[model samples]
Target: MLKVQEIRELIKLVDQSSISEFVYEIDDAKIKLKKNTTVTTVEAKPAVQQVVVEEVAKPKAVEVQAVKQETKVEAVKEEVKKDETIDTSDLHKVTSPMVGTFYQAPSPDSDPYVQVGSKVSNETIVCIVEAMKLFNEIEAEVNGEIVEILVKDGQLVEYGQPLFLVKPE
Candidate 1:
């Protein structure tokens, strides 16, 4: 069993590193850490007679949850793909600069910065990408009308992922 301080140190190290998941096991004790969307989960299983029963049940529950999440993601991807069927050869793409949560509005109660058919210029703030608690203003780099939004509000965006398609002026 790890001391409280040791577990805290491990969490700090993992959070600072690029790895997304870590697991450690010794004898009958196990520790698992997972990082997702800035949320961290730490699971510590100790040596006990019921440990086997718990370990068996936990994986099934996790598997079901993972499947459900995957299904939702797939549906969203399909919707995005349908939007992409439009001709985009001459359109300008506004892409995310970093891995972050894409926010269409400054606040939850506010209207979005831009929407389909909205005109934008090089300096126009089209959206926000939040990374590591920092809200980064994303601008449209071209003079154009927004033809489509490629991501949903509060979605996780990868670095360089296209956020919007714009029809150039």
Candidate 2:
């Protein structure tokens, strides 16, 4: 909806113009501004879907309502097939316990708990999973030699996401 100040400015512009009537339509809403010798009439209808702001400061904010529809892309699927870089077969996977950001080191200044050739035993802290400001030390459930770090530091990981690949000792 336009402000009264903006509506007044519109009335002034219309009064000075040769055009007698001005009609504007967006989505399902419509605005009709009419000028006569005696009086001026402004008619506007409410918008349809989710509100969207189109222009700024002419009215400051123009609210528009629209329903969004998502379209599937075949190109994204093809790109995923091309980016197949890892071979997860013949290795034990260390997956995430919860949805959070993964961190290799206990702190930013410290060295990573595990690397490509790092050896680990059951109960050994291999990484930290930070969720909601709490840092959790993730343990190596099985004794193994680290073969791969599947997730990068500061990457958001989902529950059951593979974080590392280990060759059992």
Q: Which regions of candidate 2 fall more than 4 Å away from where they truly are?
A: 1-87
lDDT of 2: 0.81
Tens digit per residue, CA lDDT, model 1, 1-169: 7788998999889889999889888666677888666666556675465534344534588889999999999999999989879798999999999999999999999999999999999899999999999999999999999999999999999999999999999
What's model 2's TM-score?
A: 0.50
User: Residue by residue across 21-51, what tens digits does model 2's lDDT show?
Assistant: 8876656556677777575555667555797
- lDDT of every predicted structure (CA atoms): 0.92, 0.81
TM-score of each: 0.55, 0.50
| Model 1 ranges off by over 4 Å | 1-84
